[model samples]
Structure formats: structure tokens, C-alpha cells
Target chain A: MNRKGKLWIIILLDIVLGLVFFKALIGASEELSWVYIEKGGIRPDDILSYLDRKDYGTVAIMARSYRIGSKVRDEDEELYLMGEYADLLFYERIFAEDGQTEEAADFEKRRGEIRGVIPEYESVLDDMDQGIEKGLHGVTSDE
Target chain B: MKCPNCGAEVELLDEVCPYCGAVNKESAAHRAEMKHYKERSKNAKEKACGIISENVALIVSSVVLVLLVIGIVAATYVEKNAFMFSHWAARSESLQKSAEYAGILRQYLDSGDYAAFLAFENAHVIPAYEEGYTEFEKISGMATNYVAAMNSIENVVLFGEGAKHYSVDTDISSCQRSIANFFYTYERALTDMEGDPHYGKLLDMKGKMDVALRIYLGLDEEKREEYLESSEGRQKAYLEEVLALE
Candidate 1:
């Protein structure tokens, strides 16, 4: 092969390997985050309002459980990911609203991207509720 | 007609037939042929030995590969089943707790201490439900962690149907669904009772409670005992299995 062709082959290999490594890293981070949450990393404020915080820890965990249980497909997975992403952006919004310049600009640019996916997440949640209802029916049917 | 030293046609007059001068020419030719055959045989034996020596590494490698495959399969089975067994332990523990609380409520009703029963219902029973609800959430959270870990482990661990243990996934999901339903039903009943202090909400709550208790009680005394006993055993065995793997 000519020098240019060899260079192209090397570049292609590099890109493939890079993607594989990045994916692995993402998978690891997600796993670690989940483990942390399960082991009591979730707080009441994560899911419930203070006035209704009779069982805040439980509510928070249940919310996450519903989110996870509702996930059944690649699109659902993406929606879950985007929900987490939106949470980060929402935090940025908090800071941005406090007049952090770079965060303000980035928040303005990206908040809409997260906002766009909220309806889809809500739809996924509806599907999950339906699934639970179906399950309940099944249990009752056995009786 | 032949001389001893060399084959000769003249029997008595000549000592040798001198085609090529040698004594006992027939025997000498036989010896020469035998020596040639021995040299060739030695060369063939050495070649065979060389081939066998060269293949030693290849043979060892093939055996190692087969053993490695078996080890991987065993590890996958153990890991997936261990996870499932851990979930089973958690579920059993939760069920036992629910059953215990239900038993107490049943006892209260049977004893006809309506005031005490109501107080218990308000103070302890409702809080227990809240705890159970939260516990289920934690279990589901762990399952989410499992799912994520499964994804990462799949990249490293080949032959993993760990990700496809859909039965355990369904089991946990079903538990959450049941908990949610019970919480909603029971909570609504309580709310109605608070609003009206009537028998209707009381009956509704009791009905729901009865259904739950019956399911747990239906296992018969012996089976329930066995399940309770086996849960501990399974947990211990599961831990040992995990340690063995490590």
C-alpha cells in the first residue's frame, strides 16, 4: 500500500478502538452510578417535595425504580439517559440563573435539547404504568 | 563351479572369476544393503521424533483452550445464578416481614381490641408499608445497577446470558408493581377513613389486607417453614459460592 493508504488504515483503526474504549468507559460509569444510588446514595430531595416527605427515601428510590423498570427498549434507554442529562442541565440552569456567564450561555443553548425529550420520557412512563397494570391484572387473574 | 573368494565359472582351475575382485562377494553385497537400510531407518525415526516435539506446544494450547471455555461457562452460570439467588433471598425476607405484620393485624382483629388495632394500624402498620415500599425501591435500584454492571461485564465476559435473565427482571418488576398497587389502595383507604371515619374505608383496607395475608398464608404451615429455613441456607450457600469464585 502507498503511504497515504497506510495512514488512512491507521486512522480508521484508531477511531474504532477509541469508540470501543469510550463505550466501555461509559458502561462502567453508569454501573458505578447505579450502585451508588442503590446503596443509599438517593436522598428524599431527589424525588419528593419536603411537605410530602413522609417517606422521602422510599419515594426517591421508587421513582428511580419506575424509571428503570419502564425502560424496555433502546429508545427507552436513551430517554432514561436523557433524563439524567436533563437533571445535569437543570442544575446548570440553577447556576446559570445565578449569573455564571459560561454556564448561562451553555444553559441557554442546551436546555432546549433536554426539554425536547421530556414528552418522550413522559410517554415512556405511561407505557410503564400500563405494563404494571397489566401485571396486576395477571396476578388477579391467577386468583 | 565357484570359488570361495569370488564367484568363478571355472570350478577347479580358477581361484576367482575377477569381474570385480572381492572375497565372498555375495555376502559383502548383502552386508552393504543391510547397512544402507539401517541408515535410512534411523533417518526416518529422527524425522518422526522431530515432528512430535514440534507439535507439543500446539497440543498443549488446544487442551488449554478447551479448559478455558469450560471455565468461562461455569463462571457465567455461577455468577448469574448467584445474582438471582441474592434477589430471591431479598424477596423472601420481604415477604416474611409482610406476613409477620399481617399476622399481628389478624391477631388484633381476632382479639377484638378494635381501638388498639386501629392505633397499631395508624402507628406501626402504615409505617411498615412505607418501609416495604422503600425496600422494594432499593431492590429495584440494585437491579438497575445489575443491568448496568451486566452491560460492562458483557464486554469482558463472553458467553454471558446474564443480561438475558429476564425471569429475575420480571420477578423484581412484579414485586414493585404489587407494592405500588398495595400502597395506592391502602393509602386511599386510609385517606377516606380520615375524611369520614366510616366503616367503608375500614372494610376496604381489611379486604386488601386479607388478600395479601391469604396469599402468604396459603403456602401451608410446613411450606412456609421450609421457605423460611431454606432462605437462610440459600444465602449462606450463595455467599460461599461467591467466595469460591473469588
Candidate 2:
């Protein structure tokens, strides 16, 4: 092949490698971010700062959902969603309502409804207990 | 071309500079010379391509190696935190409920209203405490297993390979300790109440319970007569005696 042809091929190959490298880096970063979020590493203060800045809304939500959902039960998608919703609304109510107002009353009513629908605190504890039991068995089997 | 030593133009075919007596090293046929330089340039470009293509595999391998390293790091991070995260989340959920229950008991304890306290104990506090104690027992049992699981994981994996030094031991032990402390505190409260001069209030609670039970059972005069003949009536008669002492 001609020199120009070979050079073009090399350039094309380099571009592909660069793209792969970047994609891998991004994927790794996103994975780690989720891990951090799941571990309760993202504090309320971390998100409150973004709320203050009025930026990274999506980021804040992602962090909040993972942080709260972890408490609900990671394997149960339904419970996780419900927990996330409850958490978000709890903060929303705090930020949006003033005392002795209709809005506050409405928020309380909604809060009660959410609490009613979500699994009871006792059940959540039971699920955690069961999960830990299973984990222990898994570890035993692995050993 | 210009003469090497003098400002004079010469024909491309000239082998020597007629004006300066300088040998015309550049006197090769102009078309041929151009062709030669173009060919050399082509050779250089090909050499460049050769070098790039030769190292292409190496470059790709290096990139892949880096990616592998990154993947391992991400995997290690997730592995380390995933279990601990769930562990802590469970602990937090349990702790929140336990704290709330403890707070309620504390409030009642602080009120110092003997009648109200007796009523609440009969109606809510005692049952809730029993339920809580049972739940804590189950929780502590599971926590023991969880600690074992965590230790198992720690044993197999290299140090620092997973979540950064999770003291699963400390975490689970603390939970167990809290449950123990809670149970002890409640037991101590009951003991103190029994020993206090206010023990009469505790006895009076039985009479309150009989009344509450009668009301709850909707005992009309006829049913009341039937109940008075039953085992529950016997218990109530005993409670009446205690209530008389109070």
C-alpha cells in the first residue's frame, strides 16, 4: 500500500484506541460513583451544596436515590423506588413548606400516605435480617 | 539556478557555472532531480507508516493494560463498599426505629404521671417493649452471622483489595451491644419501679386493665355475668384485691 494509505490507516487506528480508552475511563468512573453512592458516602451536605449552587440537579438526584435506596433493600427494585421517592419528598416537603400552612398540612397528609404504602419499618428490618442471614450462608458456602 | 559564488542565472542543464567557475552539483536533469526528491519523500513517508504500523499492536496492548487496571480498581471499590453499605443501611434502619422506641419510653418515664404511666404500660409500653426485645434478639442473631460473613470475605481477599478496612467486627458488635444495653435498661426500669414506693401504682394497673378489657369486650350485664364466671373473672378478682391494696 502507498505511504499515505498506511498513514491514514494508522491515524484511524489511533483514533479508535483513543475512543476505547476514554470510554473505559468513563465507565469505570461511573461504576465507582455508584459504589460510593450505595455506601452512604454521599452525605446530605454534599447534595445540599449542589442545591445551593443550583447546579448538577441530575447528579444530586442520582446520589440521593442511591443513598436512600440502600437503606430500603438493594435487591428489591420496588422497595428501592418507594424508598427513594419517600426520601426525595421528605426533603422537598422540608424545603417547600412553612409551618401552620395548608401546604404543610398537605405535605403531612402525603407523608402519611407514603408511609402507609411503603413497607413498615419492622418489615424493612426483617428484610435486612434475612439478607444478612443469606449473606452469612453464602460466605459459609464459599468457604 | 543562481551561480554559487556570483549573481548569475544558468540553464538547468549546465554542468558548471560559466560565470563563477563553480561546479554545478545541481546540474542533473531537472525533471529527473524532481522525480528523485519526490521518490525520497515518498520513501520517508512509507518509513513513517512502517514505524506506526509496527508499534500499533504495542499501543493497543498498552491501552488494554491500562483499561484492565482501571477495571480492577473499579471492581475492588465496588466489592469493598457493597457489603458494608448494605450492612450500614440495615444498621441505620434498625437504629432509627430503636431510637424512636427508646425515645417514647423515655418520654413516658419523664412524665412522672403514675396513673397515665400505668395505663400506658398496660396498653402500649409493655407489649411494645416485648416486641422490641424479640426483634432485637433476631437482629443480634443476624448481626452475628453478618459479622462472620464479613470476616469470611476479609479472610479470602487480599488486604486493601476490597472496601477500605471495614471494621465489620466493630459495626456488628456495636449493634449487639446496643440491643443488650436497651434490654438491660428496660429491665432495670422495671426492677426499680417494683422496688419503689410507687409499686402500688403498678398493682393498680391490673384494675385498670380489667376495666379496659371489660370495655373492649363490650360486656353487657348478661355477658358480664358470664365473664365473671370464667377464668378471666378469676384474674379480675385477683386484680381487684391488688387494686384494694392501692
Candidate 3:
């Protein structure tokens, strides 16, 4: 065709490519912003608050949320696993205390599974076990 | 060139031969036609150039504006669906693992471990709205509130345990607010669980939650029943009285 016709076609193609590129940039930005918000909002103090209260269920949820919501670093892997361990430990106590033998056994089995995977946390697990045991005492107290 | 009149050679644009001085009418007409074509070609080129030069700014501006608008639309679309797109990969993976995940969820539910079910579901980023998982929608909905209520109740119980060292007034007020929030979320959970096929299973879980509340908050069955039956104001009063005892 003519030079002008070819130029118009090139312009159209440029616009099309630009649009695709712009959309991709926006998608990346959106993903980044989301990651930033999630990662930034996860405060160690928040998890500590629940832990101080022996609310292992809430702590587990928070920790899991953080682990899933962001890219977990190698350093944080043990922390996340411990959170899961705490949750399992909490439910084990609850079920055992409530006289639900099968459910409590299930929790114990799950805890054993975790312990098998991360044997390095054995001491930490022991400490959590004792803490939750002591903490649950107050929960079951008549007073 | 040859002249047509006498077969004598002539200049290419010559209208007549000098030797014979013939009219050379054909040569003259050929030159006129060539001139006409040359003028037409030149005029066409000039006209195209003129048009482009005149509208160059307008064309550039129009294209830029179009691209700008498209960029805005693209940005807006991506921003609006960011959450969906971000979860899209995980959701697809969850769909592929639907059967396995469903089994795990079933175990949690069967065991009346709603909190663990929720934690597991969230961690895996399961698509609760998918066809295979729709059954969990109501459960998930109610469990969300149930978990929240449990969290708040735990906080109040912690205050009672002296794990937190806030002032008495602050502790009492905070505990009252926590109790109110627990009731509010519990009512919401009840609404969500209404008409669920797993209503019996859910009620059993709710019973366990109530037991937790009773054990930790000193809320006996009679007190709970009274609180549930009371008006909003009376419920507040009862919570205040309960906290006063604490």
C-alpha cells in the first residue's frame, strides 16, 4: 500500500503491543502491592499476643495465613511448622480433655507426623507441650 | 528516434524532423501524453504529502490519546481483578487436588474440628465455591465466625487468667466487648448454618464451642440460656454482671 497506510498500520500495531505490555505491568504491580500489604501487615507482636494468651488456634491461623499469603523465607519455615505443631497440640489437649478418644488420637497422630518431619524442633515442641498443658489447666479450672 | 513521416531519425521529444520538416503529428501527441502523465504523478505525490503534513499533529495526538485511554482501562481491569488473578493459580491447583483436599476436609469436619478445617482450607487456598467443594461453603462461612468468636472468647479468658495486665475497668470493658462480639458472631454463624445438610454435625461443634465458653468464661448453661433469651440491653447487663464477678 502507500506509505501513510503502512504508517497507520504500524501505529495500530504499536498501540496493541503497548496495551498488552501495560496490562502485564499492571498485573505485576497489583501482585506486588498485595504481597507488600500481606507481608507488612503480619506483625510478630500479633502472633505473640495470641501466644501469650495461649490461643494457639489463633496463632496457628495467623502464622499459616502469613506463610501462605507471602513467600516464606528459609528462616521462617521452622516458625511456620512450629505454629502448626502448636495448633495440633492445642486440639490434642482439647479433645483429650473432652474425653473424645478417637479425635484426640487423630491429633496425636498428626502431631507425631509433624514431629517426624521436623525432628529438629523437638525441644521447642517439648516446651510448647508443657506451656499448653499448663495453660489449659486454667481453661479447665472451675474457678 | 525515427520520424514517422520520412523514416528519418529525430530527437526523442522533437515534434518534427529538421530534414523533412514534416508535421510529425504522432510524435507531438506522444509528447503531450507523457507530459500529462508526469504532471498527474507529481500532483498525486504532492497531494499525499500535503495531507500527511497537515494532519500529522492530529494523527499523533489521536493515537496517543487512544493509547492513554487503553492504558487506563487495562490498569483498572487488572486492579479490579487483582485478587482473583493472584489466587487463580492456587485455585487451579486446588481444583486438581479437590478429591484429596476434600477427604482431608471431611476428616476435619467429621472430627468436629472446624477451626482446623478452616486453617487447613485457608492454608491450601482451596476454592470453596467450586462444584466439588460447594458443600463446604456454608460450613466455611459459619466456621469463619465461629473461629472469630473463639478467638475473642480466648482473649477474655486470658484477661481473666491475668495473662494480660490491663486495669480492672479496661479488662472488664474489654471482656464485655469481647462477649458481645462473641454473641454477635455466634448469631451470624447460626444464620449461616441454618438449613445446612450438616446441621447436626455443626450443632455438635457448636455444643463444643459452648462448652469452651462455659468452662473458660464461667458461663454455665443457665447463664448462657438466660443471656441468649434476654434482650440486647439485658444481655449487656448480664455480661457486665459476669465480668464484675471476674
Q: Report lDDT per candidate.
A: 0.37, 0.41, 0.64
Candidate 2 lDDT, tens digit per residue, B150-239?
A: 222212111111113234344334433332333334344456555553344333322322222232223334554554455634534433
DockQ of each: 0.02, 0.03, 0.12
**Fnat of each candidate:** 0.00, 0.01, 0.07
Ranking by TM-score: 3, 2, 1
Alpha carbon deviation, residue B158, candidate 1 (Å):
40
**Model 1 ranges off by over 4 Å:** A1-77, A122-143, B1-246
Give the distance in Å from residue A119's predicted Cα in candidate 3 to where it truly belongs. Answer: 6.7
For all candidates, the clash counts are 0, 1, 0
Q: Of 1 and 2, which scores higher on lDDT?
A: 2
Question: Model 1: what is its DockQ?
Answer: 0.02
TM-score of chain A of each: 0.28, 0.33, 0.52
Q: Which ranking of candidates, highest DockQ first? A: 3, 2, 1
**Winner by TM-score between candidate 2 and candidate 1:** 2
In candidate 3 the C-alpha lDDT for residue B216 amounts to 49
Between prediction 2 and prediction 3, the one with superior lDDT is: 3
**Tens digit of lDDT per residue, candidate 1, span B1-246?**
455554555333223355545444435555677789999999999999897686665555555555555555554454435434444444455455765655554554443222223333332323333553432232222223222322221111111111222233333334333433444444554554454323343443344333322232222334333433454445334323321211
